[model samples]
Target: MAEVPIVVHPAIEQGGRAVVVRNEVAGLAHCDREVVEFLRRVGLPLSDDILDDPVWVEWRGGRAHDYEAA
Candidate 1:
């Protein structure tokens, strides 16, 4: 299968994570719901468990619920 284009970058200052899609910045998501929203905004098909779906999202520098830098 193809690599997922959506990546939830590490949370940084401003307490948000940078959501990237296809090498472009989609938006900063602060929570799981927001991440889902961003994906929807980009017209991507995602399940309710998107945060846990490795095939759909690649989480880096933190876990799915990590919204702050460690």
Candidate 2:
């Protein structure tokens, strides 16, 4: 499959990451579930294990599914 164009931006000071779909701000996500929810809102398909799909999700400033604070 091609890249999903879904970007889970770096977590802010509050440990919440911004979910962006196609350059649009879907919403703020605090966990992996929220990221899935945001992707659904933007009309994206599931990949069985989306959070671990590097081609489906672009994670920055953090590891995949690591939105929690340090």
- Best candidate, lDDT: 1
Per-residue alpha-carbon lDDT of candidate 2 for residues 1-70, written as tens digits (9 for 90 to 100): 6766888888887888998888889998998888888888878887668778777778888777787655
Reference-based TM-score, model 1? 0.86
TM-score versus the correct structure, for each prediction: 0.86, 0.82
lDDT per prediction?
0.85, 0.82
Model 1 C-alpha RMSD to native = 1.5
- Which TM-score value belongs to model 2? 0.82
Q: Candidate 1, which segments miss by more than 4 Å at Cα?
A: none
Considering only N, C-alpha and C atoms within 3 Å, which residue pairs clash in candidate 2? none
